[model samples]
Target: MSEPLLEVKDLNIHFFTDEGVVKAADGVDLIIERGKTLCLVGESGCGKSVTSRSFLNIIPSPGKIVSGQMLYRQQLPDGTTTTIDLAALDPKGKDIRRIRGKEISMIFQEPMTSLSMMHTVGDQITETIRLHENVSKQEARDRAIEMLRLVGIPKPARLIDEYPFRLSGGMRQRTMIAMALCCNPTMLIADEPTTALDVTTQAQILDLMLELQQRYNMALLFITHDLGVVAEIADEVAVMYLGKIVERADVDTIFNAPKHPYTQALLHSIPKIAMKREELDPIKGMIPNPYRRPSGCAFHPRCSQVMERCKHITPNVTAIQPDHTVRCLLYEDMPEQVTQKEAMHHD
Candidate 1:
C-alpha cells in the first residue's frame, strides 16, 4: 500500500472540568490516503466530532491533548520523506498556523459560526487566502471565486459578494467547502458538514466533495455519525465509541462482516431505503456518558455479544483481515484456558 498522507497515532484529547478530565478523544489511530475519504462513524457524543476537531486544534481551552501524535508525511524539497508531527507543535507556534490552512484545513459543523456576518462571502474566502499566502488582493479574489466555482456554487462571481445570511442553507455549506479548499491543503477535516441540510442537499454536498476530492487528490477525514453518509461516500470507515476507535475496515467489509458487536449494531440501526418504517430497527440504549464511561470495553454494556471478560478487560485491536480491524474479545487469540472459559459460556 502507498504511504499514508496523514497518520494519527494513539491520539488522546481531554477536557478539564470541576468534576474531572473528560476524555473526548482517546487512542484514535487511523490513516488517510491521498484522494480517498476515510470517515469516522458512530452515534452522537461518541467522539467522532472531537477526533476531527482535535486535528485542527479547535478543541476548546479546557480541553487538553494528553498524548499521541498527528503525523503528516510530505516530500521534502530534496525528495525525502519528512514527517511533521502536529501534536508536538506549540499552539502559538508559526508552524501550526502555516500548516493549519496551507497543509491542513477544517470545515466546522456550523457555517454561521465560522462565517463572519460582517464580511461579504467573497471577502471571507479571500481573507483566508491572504492569511496564508502573500498574494495580491485581486489574486486572492480570483482564487476565492475559483474555489467557489470548484465546489459547484452557481454564478460564483455574483454569489461571492453576498453575505452568509443571503445564501440558502445548502449554499452556505458550499461556501464553507469553498473556504476550506481555498488553499488546496493536503488534508481536509470536515465535521458533520451536512447536518441540518435536507436529504437532497446532503446528497448534493457529498457528491460535490467527492468531485473536489478527485480534482485535488487531497486526503479527506470525514467526521460524521450518519451511516447513510458513510454508505454514500466513504472509501473506508472507522467506528468510534467513547473516545477510542473500535473497528476500522473498508466500507464493504464494515457493512458486511463487522467483527465488533457495536459496529454490527450500528449498521443494523441504519434504516434502509427499501425497508418500511414499521420494520425499521434502531440500536438499543444511548451512548454512555464520557465522564462515567464503563470500565474495560466501553461498548460492553450495549454489545449483545459481550462476553464476561469484556466487562473486565479492554480488548486490544486485532486484525481479522488485512483490511479489517476490531477491538473485541471475540476476535482475540485467547489461550486454551481463556478460550475454554469463553466457549463454555457460548455453549
Candidate 2:
C-alpha cells in the first residue's frame, strides 16, 4: 500500500466529429504503483489505447482530453519530490517535453510505423538517448550499442548500422524495447507491444519486458486485450468498456472472483486449452457505436445480469473491499464500505 507512482482520476477524452462528440474515455480512473504492472484490459476500441495516449499528451487530431487529473509523483535529481498534474500542462510546453521521454516513455503498438524507416536502428536509439541527455555523438552511439545488447540483440556493434527493415519481427520489437529503455525512464507505457507477434515470440517479448521492468524498478502500464498476458505480467487489472473502467482489482482476484459482468464475460471468452474451438463462448455483442451509446449503464444491453434499473440509472463505482471495486448495481447493497462518487455516475 505504498504511495502510487501515478494516479489518473475521472479522465475523459473525446473525439469531435461532424456527426457528434465520441466519448472515447469517460471518467476512467487508474493507479500505477512503483515497480509493478497494471494491465488495462478490454476489447478493441474500448478506449484502452486512447486513455494511455493521453498520459504522454499524444492524443491524435480531432481527439482531445476534455477533463481529468493525471497526478504523477516525480522524483527530482536533487533528492526531492514534486507532484505534477500532467493533464493541465500544455502538450508542447517545456514541462511535458522534459517529462515525456526522460521520466515517462511509451512503446507504441506498431514499431514498423513508430520507427522511422529512413533511419537505421542505431540512429533511432541514439536519437532518443541524446534527446533527454546531454552527450557527445560517440558517447550516444556507445550507449545505443549497450542498449541493443541489453535487449538481447546479437552483435550489437554490427546491427547498429542496419535498418529496422533488416530485422525480424521479434528483433524489431526488441529494438523498440531498446529505444524505450535507453533513457531509463521511471515508468513505461506499452500499448499492446506483443499483439503483432507469434505466440512464441509474444512470450519472449513479455519476459524481456518483465525482466527490464525489474532491472530498472520501473512502473509499467501495459495496455492489451489479452487476459492470458495479463495473468502473466499484471500485478493489478482494470477492465474497461466503452471508455469507462468497470472493474479494478489485483490480478488474482480478477481471475478468481470477478465482480463485473463485462469482466466475467471477457474471462469466459478466453479460449481454454481443453475446450474445443467451436465450444468457446464469446461475449454476445460487439462494442456499441460511440455516437449511439446505450442509455443508463452503457453495458446493460450486453450484460447477462442486467436489471431494470440498469437500463435507466447509471451505476456508481462501489468499493466492495479495500483492493476491489466494481461499477454495477448488483454490488450496491454489499455490506462492505462503498466509496461512491455520485457525480461521475452518468450516461
Candidate 3:
C-alpha cells in the first residue's frame, strides 16, 4: 500500500559515440520495493549494468541518461518521506554525493578492479563511513572492522591492514560487500557481484547478501544473466532484451509461465542437468547491432513466434494478469493491451 522505495519510468540512456548513438536503455521501467530483491536478468549488452549505474548518476562518459525519472522515496530522519528525482540531480554535486553511498550503494562485478590496490581495505571502508557520517578517524576505522567481521571475514582486525591483492577472490568480494553496507544504505545495487567466483563461493555470497538484506531491511537491485542465480535470490525478475524489458513477473511466473517469446527462449536456453550436451537450446540469433537496430520489435529477427505485424508495429507492454507484464505481438490482443496497442499503432 505504501509507495515503492524506488520507481523508474521510461528510462532512456544513450551513448553518443562518433559512429552513432547507442540506445543502451530505451524506455526501461523498473520498481524496487523496500526489503525485496529485483533481479535484472539478461545477456551481456542488454543494459543491465548501465541501468543500475544510472541510479547513482554514474553512467560512464560518452553515455548519459537522455530522459526519464528515477524517483527515490527517501526516508528523512524525522520519519517523513520525500521523493527525489535522482536523474535530474547534478552527477558531481553534493546532493548526489551525499546520497550515493549513504542511501544507495553499489557493488561492481569484479572486486579486484573495484577495490584500490594502493590502499588498505580498512582505509577504503573507513573513507566511505567518514564521508557520509560526521565521525572521527578512529570511530570510522572501528566501524569498518566491525563491518568486515559481519561479512564473515576472519581476523578482520589484522586483515583490515592488508591490501586487496593479498586476499582471495571470495574474501575481496566479501570486503566489497562490507564496504557497500558500511553506510547501512537503504538500497543496494549489485552488478554481477558473484559472477567471477566459483559455484560454492557464488552461493555463499548470494546467501550472505540475502542475509544482510534481511538484517538491514534494504532493497536489492541485482543485475545478473544467470537464471540459476535469479531462481536462488530474486523475488521479482525483469527480462531485458537489447535495451528494452520484454517481460517482468514474480520469479515463479518468469520461470514457469513466461509470456514473451524472448523470455520463453531464454528459459529454454538454460541447460538442463539431465539433458545431453547437444540438446542445449541457445537462442537462435545473435543480438542485433546497436547502431542498426531492427525495425519494430528488436527480437523479431530471432523470435520464433514472429508475426507480420512485428516487422513494423512495435508491441506495447501488456499485462496478462495482475503483476505480470509482457511485450510481444502474441499478447497484443489481450484485453488489457487494447488501449496501449491503439496508442502505439497511432504513433
Model-by-model lDDT, in order? 0.85, 0.90, 0.92
Better of 1 and 3 by TM-score: 3
Clashes (backbone N, CA, C under 3 Å), per candidate, total: 0, 0, 0
Output the better candidate (1/3) by lDDT: 3
Give the poorly placed runs of model 3, Cα more than 4 Å off: 334-347
Question: How are the candidates ranked when ordered by TM-score, highest leading?
Answer: 3, 2, 1
Worst lDDT run of 10 residues, candidate 1, spans 338-347
lDDT tens digits by residue: candidate 2, 95-185: 9998897789888779885688899998888888898999998999999999999989999999999999888989999999898899998
Which ranges in model 2 have alpha carbons more than 4 Å from their true place?
Answer: 334-347
**What lDDT, from 0 to 1, does candidate 3 have?**
0.92
Off by over 4 Å in 1: 77-80, 336-347
Q: What is the per-residue lDDT of model 1 for residues 93-186, given as tens digits with 9 covering 90 to 100?
A: 7878888877788887789868988889999999999999899999999999988988888899999899999889899999998998998888
Q: Let me know the TM-score candidate 3 reaches against the reference structure.
A: 0.95
- Pairs that clash in candidate 3: none
> What shift in Å separates residue 107 of candidate 1 from its native position after superposition?
1.3
What lDDT tens digits, residue by residue, belong to model 3 across residues 170-285?
Answer: 99999999999999999999999998999999988999999999999999999988898899889999999989999999999998888998888988999878999889999998
> Tell me, what's the RMSD of every candidate?
3.1, 3.4, 2.7
